[model samples]
Target chain A: MNDLTIIITLIAIGYIAGTWAEKRHYRSIEKREREFLDLPAITIKNVDIDDAKVKNAEIVYGGAVISVDYFKRILAGLRNIFGGSVKSYESLIDRARREALLRMKTMAPDATMIINVRIETSTIGRKSHKKSVACLEAFAYGTAIYLKG
Target chain B: MKYTARMPETNVNVTPTSPLREFFVLLSGVIAIIVGIYLLLGLALNIIVPRIPMTFERKLAGPFINSMASVDRSSEKAQTAQKLLDVIQKRYAKLPYTFTVYLQESPRINAVALPGGNIVVFSGLLEKIESENELAFILAHEMGHYVNRDHLKGVGRALVFIMISAMLLGPDSSAGNLLAQSLNVTEMAFSRNQETLADEFALNALHGTYGHVGGSADFFIKLSKEANTGLWGHYFSTHPENLKRIAHLKNYSRIHGFAEKLLRNIPAIINKKRPA
Candidate 1:
């Protein structure tokens, strides 16, 4: 019975706090994304820009690690039993990758564009020896291009 | 020059789902499935439990009872209980089980009828037994379980989930543990009917052994007066309410014309010493 109470408390805290945090984060992400709209981040390895017009190109990368809330963890656990898409984890991965891209764009304010952009994801921060979802990491890396007028 | 950066109007990667809604839907689905299985298995158990042969039962029960094999089985308290149990089994109950009593040193007043003819008697209940007839009633009540195989029915339904969770989530997983526990809380159907039948059997066993149903309700009479708050709660939960059980016992004994005779004293070796 004590374990039951603890699980319920954790799930409640997770849902309440996880939703609030995700909402605030998405708001901030949207605002930062708009601010960085001028700096295009693309997956194309090469662009049509002439070499003569290029200034300096440098590697810019950013990574974000997001942990799942208890509610989502339990939801995913149930999904594991029933065998279906883990919708609860979709938002966590979405936030991590978007946040990483936003941070990567923030690092190169004056760049004409970011090309060859790539995002990598992996699971990390698992504290127990048993298989479990603890935290996820999203890394966004690209070559930032500066142009000479 | 025409490359104007704009956020995609929709997030294709993340589904715009209400996590709460999904959580609840999936939660309810799983609960419904479990409840369905519980109901189905409960019915199946009634038909299947009796067909389970005694040899196979002892084999399946080997691992569980073997663990308690190391516990003291030949203590003075154990021998007395076993002797009384043998008398009740041979003369009155005549159950197919070769009943053996395992005296566990616990402060809880409960006796459990495990699979494979093992009756675990706790020290606290030993202390509560004022007469040999009352002790016989407790042992006989457990023997009554063997008569109807209520113990196996209760455990069989609960065991299905325990095994499934262990197979799917591994034995040590908290989720698995929780799943087993939730089913156990709901599936242990020691229903009022089973309890009443057992009470009736115990009354009959008391009459056969002593020629009178004397001191059959004394233990429950004592239990009701005590503060049954902590460990005492399990006994009450698994069995019927003390008052209801006592009432049923009286009614059955009166209908059978079994009178309360002089109570037999419990052996001194089986009694607990009061702190002076």
Candidate 2:
């Protein structure tokens, strides 16, 4: 096939598959976020809860690596040329960070809150030759504290 | 009831958001603006470059060409090249500028035209031609660039690109290097268009000189045979595919009635002694 045909096919596949995947993920994240609403994860470095009142406390963490779809990759490539914020990528990072925090909350179900939550993100799967970024990884970690009943 | 410790399952979210819509809209807008600017600049240059006096263009380009490549005048190959240039110059007597052809000893099969009326023909290109007609086609191609003032326009565009890049990237950064590289690819597409126009010039000039445009595409035919190594071999190249160029030359010759007078036998110039 010619170049135009190949490019059109890629864009079509990326749109259909990427849109479907993104929609499904958003739904799942929304549902779980509602369930985990009471489990607050704050970025504060210091915990104000009284030590004597705390019965159990443990470090909890969650991590994830998400691959970018072709549609977003193509858009990001265009953004690189024009030099601007790549909003598609921004959403990708957002989903990853939120998912990581949710997983950490799930780990300490008995805890009142998860304090000093930190989210760290980095890019992966970058080859020297390729123009588009492949995958991004986000890790969320925090201290889960349980109050004495 | 005793509490049981249970591991939490990791939940991975790979969801689409409204930002995807914004990404495509913004990207399309940016691409449209870039293309609009490119077209405007191209049109402006076409009108401005040809009107610049030949003497002024030569004065501006001559020193740069001299500094970039060493001219080889004493070699036997240079003498043969001079002979071909002399013939072409005589055939196109009413040219706007006096043509000065220089022979540069290089291994790459290429020729280039610099502003003013200077043409640099590489020794490697000279050694590959099977006839003086093929040589004439190459020289005429360069002459075509000279006639159309493409070299000066190219320089003008380069300066514009550099200035814009400097303003956008600042100095001494890796991002600046990437910007330069991307700009180079864009500039190459512009150069390819100029090459196509020059090819047309060469075709007409060859027909005028030899009564036929035969051998006008010999160099391109040779290059096409070596072009297919892989997908990326010639994809982003500045020159159009050699096969495409040859096809265009043939098409031009057919319409101009020059195809009927094609030479049947190869010229003896191919068997000339190599410069020691």
Candidate 3:
């Protein structure tokens, strides 16, 4: 291989080594991943969803997911900087809407169907997404508890 | 008598400055005003920007040493004398590698540390002092620089100034306008809290090593007297008057009862030699 290829390989190795070292050091200091003991209610800004009785009941469990392809589209939108339609992140928003439903489904006691479901959407800047990269990668989650009548 | 034939020197006959000359003068005056305004704006921006705390150690100290050449020519001697000073430093080998001292042959009774472990002391300060404890106290204070990582923090702050100046004003600005951003050669006078912490650290070292907390605190009182007049008083741009610092030290020793404690623990601690 050429000298440039060799140098690039070395740099890649060094980067991996450095990342590993930092990970190891932090792991040594604090070995356990902190458990999530509490979660706050999620809501769209300004608009209130009217399911207060169901929502007020303690939420038990919830999850969110987006197609891997959809995630790439969202990332591309963020990278476009001064370009691209930010609304393409709707996949993430949809996932969050689904998770909110799931949280209620899991928490509710033998509940059949949930009603008065609502979802709202907004666009965040490219910089904001970078600051919360883990959250940006997929979708969001929330829950609403309910009882089967 | 022909009035037209009158030779020179008549006030009325003086040639009036031309309209073109007047326009050029007005243009020059306007240009000068614009330049002055630009410089003032740059200075204002430099002051308003806050310094960031990044780990820029060597880059900051290198330029500071170069700048000190204008104030004192014997920086080379100062650099060389660090080896001799290391003999004194050897007494505290348990301390980390970061603690160091440099002796510059300057007439001013000043000692300061650059960001990173770059400590510079004027030899004149040593000449003026009578006791070894006084020298140890000053060195210990500078050691506080290394322990507290003052250099790294200070440089970080200065870098923030440079970045702001580059962003708001062009980087290639005039020297006078940038002087506000320049890192002063003396260790930036730390806050009262920081000063107290350093003094306390030195007091501990004094009591622990020589069993002489009184000597260390008394030296501060002497320096406080010296600092009231001549070059010493003028040196501090930010630190409180030395008398105030001395008063605090005396009170600290009295309240802490350092001397008696030193006497109590001397034999056991001497044999053990605890890590500083």
Candidate 4:
């Protein structure tokens, strides 16, 4: 096939597949997020609950690594040249952070609240040969609290 | 009564994981984009090069050639050089510009064709040539550069590379050197095609001048032997393998019946006299 046809087909596939996957992921995240509303996760420095009300507290953590789609990568590369915000990469990081937080919540399903929640992000699969970032790991850690009966 | 302050709070949202399938899709897309850009640039250059005028090319090459060392016209090697050049020039008398051959005093076995029909022949190459036919082949190959106007195309490409590098990497940037090195490699890649075309032109010219393609591959055959033991062998060298060129010449000669008129044991006529 001709170069133009091949390039067009690649771009089309990237756009359609990338958009569909992102939307599906967001929907799934939203449904899971609704289920975890009762177990509120917060980044506050300290919890206000009385010591008598706190039965037990333990550290809980969740981590995940997410890879960016080709469509988003191409957009990010173009943004590098023009010098502006890369919205696609922004979404990619957002998804990773949220996924990490959800996993942390899953670890303490019976806990009343998780406090001092922190998120750390790092890049993975960054080989010298590939120009773009392959994957990003997001780790979320917090102290889970169980209220006394 | 004192009012109680509400505690500062931060909300947490879950992010979805990216599937393995998406990574492959993105990688393939990026590869396609890179390939597309490379093809486009190649197509543009192929179309643009031939349109450039010869006068502009001469002006561009003039300074570079002037800075190189040249041999004195009174030298005995220069006299022999002129005789070989005269025969080639007579064959191509209809060339638009005046053709002149300059003998360089260097020991490097090389020849170069500059713009405005100026050809430079190294003393080492002259010493290594076994017969007049071999010298004629070398001269004709250089003439092929003039006919195809490859020098101009090379200069144009170099200027483009420099301009792009300067724009992307500032003048003092260390990356400028890297860019230049890559450009040199690309230039060498382009030379492979030009070299093949020049060889064809040389073969036809040799047949016309000597009534055969005899001794045409002698220089390349000798070089192939030396190339094997050389520090910078044909593997890393810019030009194609010498053995491949020799085989090509032999095949062409056989197919065209030029091998039938082969002249054997022709002694070197130019090296008989030494300069005073």
TM-score per candidate, in order? 0.74, 0.53, 0.40, 0.54
lDDT of 3 by residue, B1-276 (tens): 211212224323222333234334444564455446544544453354224232445455667766765334344444333543354355542345443456565566667767646677776565555445565566666666555555454555555545554553357544324343343422244344556676777666665555666456554566666655656653444445567777777777788786532222111211222134
Model 4 misplaced stretches (Cα beyond 4 Å): A1-80, A83-149, B1-45, B53-56, B69-79, B172-174, B183-189, B229-236, B260-276
| Model 3 per-residue lDDT at B98 | 49
Query: Which candidate has the highest TM-score of all?
Result: 1
Candidate order by decreasing DockQ: 1, 2, 4, 3
Per residue, candidate 4 scores C-alpha lDDT tens digits across B119-212 of 8777667767777777778888888887777766665565665665566445555555554665477567788888888888888887777777
Residue by residue across A50-135, what tens digits does model 3's lDDT show? 55434344324444432223223423433354343433344344444444444444454443223334444333333544433223
Give lDDT tens digits, candidate 1, residues A2-79. Answer: 555787899999999999999999999999998998899999998998999999999999999999999999999989
Tell me, by DockQ, which candidate is best. Answer: 1
The C-alpha stretches of model 2 lying farther than 4 A from their native spots are A1-149, B1-42, B171-174, B228-236, B260-276
Could you say which candidate leads in lDDT?
A: 1
Residue B91 lDDT (model 1): 87
DockQ of each: 0.39, 0.08, 0.00, 0.04
What digit string (tens of lDDT, one per residue) describes model 1 on residues B141-229? 98898889988987887677666666655666677677766665564454667878888899999899889988999999998888555
Query: How many clashing residue pairs appear in each of the predictions shown?
Result: 0, 3, 3, 5
If the candidates were sorted by their lDDT against the true structure, best first, what order would they fall in?
1, 2, 4, 3
- The better-scoring model by DockQ among 1 and 3 is 1
Q: State the TM-score for model 1.
A: 0.74
